[model samples]
Target: MSTHRPLRIVFAGTPEFAADHLAALLNSDHEVVAVYTQPDRKAGRGKKLQPSAVKQLALEHAIAVEQPEKLNTALAQQQLAEYRPDVMVVVAYGLLLPEPILTTPKYGCINVHGSLLPRWRGAAPIQRSIWAGDEASGVAVMQMEKGLDTGPVLHVERCAIDAQETSASLYKKLAQLGPRALVTTLDDIESYRERAEVQNHDAATYAKKLSKDEGKIDWSDATQLERNVRAFNPWPFAWFELPGGKPGQRTVKVHQASVSQTDHRSAPGTIIDCSPAGITVACSQGALTLHSLQLPGKKPLPVSDLLNGYATTFAIGVNLTNVD
Candidate 1:
C-alpha cells in the first residue's frame, strides 16, 4: 500500500518500451484512465495488419485504447479531454501532441525519454549511443514541451555502457530502468515538477533515425566497423559486398565481430586468414575478426560453422569489396 495520492494518468505510447512503462503504472497506486497508441501497421511476410505492443497490452487490461492518425484534429483533442486526466505520460508515442492536448491534463504532459537530456535527444538514441562509442546511457523523465525533448528533467536513472554492449542489449537495460524511474517520479509528482532542472541546450546532440542504407560496411577503420556491427545488430545489420559474385548474390550481413590482434600488411577488405576460430580481414588502422555472418537468404551462423560449406567462398586472399 502506497501513502501517496493516486493520480489519474493518461498513458500514450506505441512500442514495447512504452508498454513496459504502462505496466509499471498499472501496478502502482495510480489510476490509468485511458491509453493511446499508434494505428496498426502492416508487417511480416504476410503483410497483415499488426497492433502495436502498447495497444495489445492495453486491450488485455481492458483499458480504453485510442488510435488516432493525428492528434492535431479537433475530434482527437476532444476525445483526450474527456479522460479528465491528472497527468499525461508519453513514452515513444510516435505522434506529436498539440498545445491544447498538452494543457488539458491537470499536471500537463511528461515524457519518459530513452537518453539523458542534452545528449542523444531524438528517435534512435540507443543505436546512436553505441554507434558513437558513448561510455554511458540512461533514461530521463522530463516535462514535455513543444520543442523536441527540450523539456526540463524531473528525474534520471543512469547506467554504464559495457565494452561489448549492443543496441539490443542496451535497449532492454533502459526498458527495465525507465519504468522504475517513472513510477518514482509520479509518486511525488508535485515536488519533482518543482525541482525539475533545465537542460543545457548548447550541449544537446540530435540522434537521427536509422535507415537500412546506414548499415553498409566500408572496411576502413577496424574500431568503427566493430562498433557499427554492434550498434546495428538485429535490424539492418552491418553488411558488405561479397567479392567475385553477381549483384544480387554479393550482400553478406555481419552478425558479430571484434578487433583482431594479428598484424597484417594486406590491403583493406582482403581476407588475411580463415579458420575454425574466425575469419580475419585486414583494414587500414587494424584488423577485424568476424565471428558470425549471414549469407543471402541464410540464417546467421558462426564462422566456424559456415566454414563447413562455404569454405571456398570465404577463402584466404579473397577481398570483401567495399562497393555497394
Candidate 2:
C-alpha cells in the first residue's frame, strides 16, 4: 500500500505460524526475493527429517529457500546482501538476527511477535499468556532490533482470550491476525516506522520457554492446575506420574480439565469420584474434574470413552498427585 516502489522482501521464519504469514505475503503484490528457514530436522516417531512449514510453502511458490544455521556469520550476511532486499519480514524465526542483519535492508527488518510489546517478550509468549490467565492477548508488528522482542511497535491487533482458550487455540488466532496487521503497517511503512512507540523496558516480563518438567501438574492450587491443563496442551501436555502402575510407574496426560467445587476432605491427589462426567481429583483448595486424558502412546479420549476401556485407571481413593 506504500506509495513508494514495490518492496523486494526477504522472508525469514520456520514454524507453521510463520508460514501462514509468508503464505499471505506471497499472495500480495510485493516480491519475496528469498526465504530463510531452519534446516529440516527429524520429527515424529520415525524421526524423519522434516522441512519447516515455511520451507514447504516457499518451495510450492518456487521462491528461493536458504537454511543457514547461523545468520550472524559473515557468509550468511553477504548472501543476504546479494539479494539487495528493500526490507525483511521475520516471524517466529527461532534464530536471532544479529544487529548487522537487522540493519542491513533499507527499510530494516520487521517482526510479527505473538504478544503485545513489553509483555511476554521472550519465547513461548502464547503459552505464557494462557498460563498467566490473561483476559486478552494479541500480536505486535515491530521494527526489528538487537534485543529480544524489544523493538518499537508499528502496529498491534488485540483479541479477547476465551476462558477455555488453550495455547493451541490462541496460537492460531494470533497467526491469522498478525499478517493482516503487518500488511497494513507496510502500506505506509516509513510513516508508521517514524511514529513507532518505543517499548517500556521496565514493564517487560520474559515468557520463559515451556518445558516438559513444568507440565507435571502441581495440585497445590486447583485454579493453577486447570490453567496448566489448558496452557500445556498440544505439546508437553499436562501430565502426572503415578507411583504404582503396571510398570511401577505410569505417566498420564490430562488433555481437558476444569476446576471443581465438589466438597471433598480427602488429601490432594485423591480420586474423589469417577463418573460419566469426569474423574474428580481433590486438590489443595478444591477439586479438578479431568474431562479428557491420554495414556502413553494412546490417543486423547473423553473420560466416558476411557472409562469403557480402563475403568480401573481412575479408581476412587487412588492418589493421582505424583509430579515427575
Candidate 3:
C-alpha cells in the first residue's frame, strides 16, 4: 500500500449496488465516519418495513446511520456536517443532494455512475445500454455537480456487453468492477482530482427511468424485442398477450429468448412454430424464439416444459397479440 493518509469518508446510497461499494470502503484503510441511506420502505409479500441493503450493512458494522427523507432540511445538513468527512461518496442514493450537502466535505462529493460519461447520463443506464444495443458498458467515478450525472470523470472501469448479457448479469458485473474502481480512486483522490477530465456535453444521451408500460412487447422489430427481453428481466418483464384471451388473462412474460432468422410470411405476433426447443413468433422484420416464459401467477419455465401442460396455448398458427 502507498503511504498516503486514509481519509474520512461519508457514504450515501441505497439498494444492493450501493451496499457493494460501502462494503469495499469498510474493508479499506479509510475511516467511514457515517452512512446515509433512504428511509426504510415497505417491501415483500408481507409488505413490512425493511431496511435498505446499505442500512443493514452499516448497522451490522455499528457505523452511525442516517435516514433522512430529504437532505434539504437544516437538521439533515447539520447532522451530515457533524461527520467532518474528507470526501463523500454517493452511489444510487435515490435522494438528490442539495447545494449545501454538495460542498459540505473538503473534497465535495463524488458519484459512482453506472455508465460511461457523455453516453448514458441518468437513471436506468444499465438497462438502457443493453436495450440500445451498446457494445460495452462500465462505471465512472466522477466529481458530483448540480447537473444530473454531468460530472468530471476521475476514473473509469469498463467491460464488454456479452451477446447474452441481461440487466441482472451486467448489474452484477459492474457491481464487482465498481467497488474496486472506487477504492482505487480513493487511494489517490487528490491526484485523480487534479487530472479529472471534463465530459463532452454534445454526445450526452439521457437514460430515462423504466416503467411497467415500457415492458409491453412490441413485435415490430425482433432484434429490439430480444434486447428488451434481456433488459427488462426481473422487473416489469417484457410481456405480450394471447390473441383471444381477455385483457388481464392474456399477459405472458418472456424470461429468455433469442433471434430467429427463419423466413416467415405470417403477420407480426403470429406463432410460426412451437417445439421443444422454443416458440418461434413472427415479427415485422424477423422472428423471435422464446425459450423461457411465465404466465399470470405461474413460475417461468422453458418452452418445452410449458408445452407439456399448455400446448394449445402456444400451438402453431395461434396469434400472439402485441398489447400496447
Candidate 4:
C-alpha cells in the first residue's frame, strides 16, 4: 500500500484499452489530475467526428481532458506542464510524447503495453500474437522513454491465447488484466527505490501496425485457417472475390472459422461443403470450417443461412480468385 499522500497522476491514452485503465484509476486512491487523448476524428460510414472511448469516459467522470494534435507543439507542452503531475500513466495513447513531455512529470511517464516485453514492442501486439500463432501473450507495464515500447518493464501479467481467441476477445482480456498490473506497478512506484531494468534489444520483435489493405485473403498461397478465418476477424477482413455471375464480381468476407488437422486430402480453398453449420474448406495440411461470413451490403451470417438466401453453393473445386 502507498504510504505517501495520494499522488496526483496524469493519464495519457486513447481507445478502449486505455479507457479500461483510466476507469480502474478512477476507483483507486490516486488522484487523476488530467487526461490526455487524441483529438476526435472522422469515423463510421458517414465519417462523423466521434470522440475516442477514453475521451468520452473521461467526460463522464468529470476529469479535465486535452486533445492535442501534436505533443511537440509548445501550447500542448505548456498545458501538460501546468498539471504538475507526480507521474503520468500512458496506455496506447496513439501519439508519441516528445522528449520534453516524457520527462515533464516528476516520476516520468509509465506505459501499459499489451505484450510481454522485450518480445512484442510495437503497435498491434494482440493482433500480431494471433497472426504469429503464439500460444500465450501478456501485458507489461513499463517506465516509458522516448522509443516505442522500449521502456523497462516494472510488472507483467500473462494470459493464454486460446486457439479460438480473436483480436476482439484477446483485447477484452488484456483490458481487464492491464488494470490489475497497473495497480501493482503503482504500488511499487510508491516505494521509490526500485531500479527500472533495461530491455534486451536482441530479443525484441516488432509488431507493425495493421492496415485494411493487409487484410486481403490469398487462398492460393495461405492455409484455409490462416487466410479464410483467423487472420481476417475484425478489420480488413480476409475475403475472396467471386467471379461475375449476375451483377458483377462480388467480395465475400469470412469472419469465423475452425481448423482441423485430421484431413489433408482436398486442395486448399476447395469448398468441401456449405451447410447451416458453416462453409467447410480444404487446406494444404488440414481442413477449415467457416461459421460466419459477410457479403456486400449484408450482415454477418452462418454459411448455411447465407446459402439459403443466395442459393449459391461454395462447392468443391471453386477457386476463390485472389484480387490482389
- Going through the candidates in the order shown, the clash numbers are 0, 0, 0, 0
Cα error, residue 63 of model 1, in Å, equals 0.6
Which whole-number lDDT from 0 to 100 does residue 324 have in model 4?
38
Best by TM-score: 3
- lDDT digits (tens) for residues 1-324 of candidate 4: 454556789999989889999999898888999999999999999999999999999999999999988999888888899999989999989898899998898889899888889887898788888888888889998988888889888888999988778888888889889998887777668453265677999999998888865775544433434632564468767766665544434777778866644454666667776667766676566666777888877898887677776545465556555233
Q: Give the best candidate by lDDT.
A: 3
TM-score of each: 0.96, 0.95, 0.97, 0.89
Error of 2 at 111 (Å): 0.6
By lDDT, highest first, what's the ranking? Answer: 3, 1, 2, 4
Q: Candidate 2 on 69-137: residue-level lDDT in tens?
A: 998899999999999998999998889899889889999999999998789999899999999999999
Score candidate 3 by lDDT: 0.93
Candidate 4 or 2, higher TM-score: 2
Query: Candidate 2 lDDT (Cα, whole model)?
Result: 0.89
**Tens digit of lDDT per residue, candidate 3, span 200-244?**
999999999999999998788999999999999878889987766
The model with the greater lDDT, 1 or 4, is 1
| Per-residue lDDT of model 1, residues 90-124, tens digit only | 99999999999889999999999989887999998
Candidate rank order under TM-score = 3, 1, 2, 4
Model 1, residue 6: distance off in Å is 0.8
Root-mean-square deviation of every model: 1.8, 1.9, 1.6, 2.7
> All models: lDDT?
0.92, 0.89, 0.93, 0.79
